[model samples]
Target: MDLVIKNGTIITATDTYKADIAVEDGKIIMIGKNITQTEGAKLVDASGKYVLPGAIDAHTHLEMPFGGTTSADSYEAGTRAAACGGVTTVFDFVIQRKGQGLIEAVEGRRTICDPQACVDYSFHTAITDLTPEILEEMKESVEYGVPSFKLFMVYKKEGLMVDDGVLAKALEKSKDIGALIAVHAENPDLIDMRIEKFLSEGKTSAWYHYLSRPEFVEAEANKRAIHWAKAFDAPLYIVHLANKEGLEEVTKARNEGYEIYAETCPQYLHFTNEVYKREDGRNFVCSPPIKGKESQEALWKGILNGSIQTVATDHCPFQSYEKDWGKDDFTKIPNGCMGIENLYPYMLSEANKGRISFNKVVEVCSTNVAKIFGCAPQKGTIAAGSDADIVIYDPNKKFVVSKENMHSDVDHTIWEGIELKGYPVMTFSRGKLVYKDGQFLGTPGHGQFIKCKGRK
Candidate 1:
């Protein structure tokens, strides 16, 4: 054994037990009671703490270009923040260029992330131009170890939206290639109409941003995407699912035995559209804007009832000055929030309050993401033969989220001042201690690019 973590309560997706885990060469070599210690193996006493698998944040946009500017966090800063939050692996989007192939986009993204990533990562191609040739490249994409593709159902003006025919064809091709199709489900045409109406009426505040994307806009698109997925018998993954109606559609399809999976972010679980009325409401602007209280409650139910499979952070942030671009016109505000470093702490805090079980948090935050994205058996679990991606969680640790205490490069965070009782005190990525207490100890470029396989 090279390292041993002792006297901790191990929480997995399905079970909770007390055990000591032994690691050797970045992999779990043994897990049991009172494991014999090696002569020179470093020992970590995890008394009075919970040992959980390192979380997998399956959605993020670090250094991503949007709304005429790139996001504030670069790959180094974002993954360092992720490590501080106990996220050992991240799946970032590889946005396709106007004339680039899907695999080419992945390769291009590697140049930016490969040298700076502080934790293991993978890519999901976001197709902007889905021609016949691109559709044929789906198989090669899967073979290239990136088996997921994303399409926007909105953002028509930005040239990111795909038509219904393109979506259907991509879904069919993904199914044939054993790849998963993820969608940003929102009705673009309806949204455009609402935006035009708001601008015409001079109702251009951040509140109107929320109104432009009512729950039905997202619900209709989710239902329509599921309809197409069913027609093609393809697996569909909905990212950042926020509204009740959309979740209902996801539940219905899942109940019908379709492979419909949905992920909800921490922002939707915490804030609502009421934030849009704040003086700094422009900072809260995001697509499919946070819904009302009823929708928020329904999403919690969906989480408990198995409709929502994973919880991630759609963690794209802008500088406060950049967000200020939409002070008078909400259309110019970048649509995202800072939550990668807040995701695990917030969920575990809620779990500490008994809103959810600890095992369930582990399931949604780590296990389900790995299973859905095909990082399982190697990551997501603390068993023998699995990578030692682990977090030492202190249920009694208290902390308030602030930009000063966070690790991202963003000037401000939407999660500021949100106090948390439970937090990850230490994070180990593949047996390497990357973050502990409040310091980052890992080197840049230490993170290898994860070649993700197809989901089972």
Candidate 2:
């Protein structure tokens, strides 16, 4: 044995028990009562703590370009923050340019990420320019280990939106190639109309950003996307679903035996549109802006009722000066916030406060994301034959959220000043300790690229 962890309560998606785990060659070798320690093996005592699987963040945009400025977090900074937050694996979007192929985009992203990532990483191809040749490259992408693709329903002016015909055709191709199609559901025309009206009325404050995208705008596009998915009989995944009406559409389609999956973010669950009325409201501007309080409650209910399957952070942050670009015009502000380092800690804190069960926390934050993104037994479980990706959580450790203690490169955080009752003290990726007691131990160029499998 290379290492042994003793006296910890193990928590899985469906089970919880007391066990000692032994690791060798970066894989879990044995899990039982009182695992013996070898002469040269390292031993860790996890007394009174919860030993759980490492988290998997399936939605993030690190170092991505938007509105003439790149996101503040680099691959190294983001992945290091992920490790500090107990995330062992991340799935970032690889956006296809106007004339680039899917595989070309993947290679380009790898060239930038291969030497900087501190945790395991993978890509999801976001198609902006769909052609006959690009459609063929979708199959090549899946064969090359990326089985999920994304298309935007809004952002028509940015040249990222796909029309109904293109969406339907993409769904058909996904059905043929055993890939999942994910969409950013929002009605562009309605949003454009509302924005024009707001500007004409001289209402360009940060609150106008929330007013421009109402619940129905998101609901209508969600319903339309489900319509196309049903027409093609293919599985559809909704990314960063926020509104109650959109979730209702997801519920209805799911009840009828359609393969529809939805993921919600921490920002939507914890904050409402009221945050936009704050003094620094420009810092809270994100696309498909935060909804009302009722929508927030509805999302919590959906998670308990099994309508929402996963919780990830759409973690794209801009510096304070960058956000000031829209001090007068809400449209000029960047559309992202920092949450990659808060996903697991926030959810675990909620569980500790009795808002939900610890098992449900593990399911939403780790197991479900791994299963849906095709990293299953290798990444999301604590059993023999699985990788030793583990987190030693101190459920009673009270810590305040602040940028001073965070590892990301951003100048500000949306979660600042919030106190968390539970936090991760140590993290292990493939049996190697990377973070412990507010310090980073992982090196750059140590994280491997994961090739995901498709539905077969």
Candidate 3:
């Protein structure tokens, strides 16, 4: 045995109990009561603490380029923040440009991430152009352990949007290749008309970003994507589902036996479009902009009733300075914010209250995310033979959200001043203590790539 964690209430996506967990060669070797410690083995007494599998953030665009500026968090800084926040694995997007081959897009991203990640990571190839060559290359990515693909229904101007025919072909490719297709559902034509109208009427404020792409935009696209995926018999995963309309679409599809899933983010759940009224509201600008408070309640209903399966941070980071670009023109603001470092604490804090259960949090934050991305049983479990990626959470640990106390290179946090009752006191990734008590103990490149299995 290399290490032993004793007297901790082990939590799984479906179960919880006090037990002793043993680790060897970066895997959980034994989990039982009163296991005798071997000589030279490090012992950690997790009394009164909750031991859970480290979170797996399924959505992040680390160091991605958008709006003429790169996201502030590089792979090193992003993964380091992920570790500090008790996330053991993250799936960052690899976008294929118009002239790039799938291999070039994927390998290029890997070249940067492989040497910089501080926690295990994987890639989700985003399809901007579904050419025959690119369609064929989808199989190569699946063979290389990336079994999921991302498609955007919006972003037409940025050259990232694909029309319905392209989406049909992409879904066919995913179905044939045994891969999952995740869509960012927002009606682009509607948004274009709305944005033009708003600008023509001189309604160009930070808040107009939300007004231009309202919940109905997302809902309409969600239904359309579901229809397309269903017609092609391809499984669908909707990312960043914000309002009731999308959740209703996902729920209906799921009930009709269509293979479908959806996820919501904390920004949508906690902060509403009202944030745009603030002076610094430009910082909250993101695609499929945050909706009103009713939408937040709708997302919670989806979670409570099983319509929504995960709560991943669409952690596309940008600093306030970059956000300032859109000061006079809301559309110029880089569309993303920092959240990889807050994924675990924000959810755990919600669980600490009566809003959600610890078990449900484990499901959304860890277990189901791994399953959805096909990294499961390896990255999301704490049982024997699973990777020793675990977080010891102190239920009583108190803290408030602040950039000064965070590990991300960014200078601000959207969650500033929000107090919390629980925190990840110790995080172990593959048997290594990577983070402890607000300090990062691991170096960049310590993390490696996880080979995800095909979904659907």
Clashes of 1: 0
Q: Candidate 2, residue 350: CA error in Å?
A: 0.3
Off by over 4 Å in 2: none
- lDDT of candidates 1 onward, in order: 0.92, 0.92, 0.91
Per-residue lDDT over 256-287 for candidate 1, one digit per residue giving the tens place of the 0 to 100 score: 99999999999999999999999999999988
Clash numbers, per candidate: 0, 0, 0
TM-score of candidate 1 on Cα atoms, chains taken together:
0.99
lDDT of 2 by residue, 304-388 (tens): 9989999999899999999999999998999999999899999999999999988898898889887887878888888899889
Taking the tens digit of each residue's C-alpha lDDT, what string does model 3 give over 1-456?
999999999999899899999999999999999988999989999999999999999999899999898989999999999999999999999998997887788889889999999999998989898888888988888888988889989899899999999899999878888999999999999999998998888887799999888989888999999999999988999999988877888899899998899998988888999999899999899877889988889899888888899999999878898899889888788999788989889899899988988999999989998888888788898989999999999999999989999998888988899888899999999999999999999999989999999864
Name model 3 segments beyond 4 Å from true. none
Ten residues in sequence with the least summed lDDT for candidate 2: 368-377
Q: What is the lDDT of residue 319 in candidate 2?
A: 98
lDDT of 2 at 214: 82
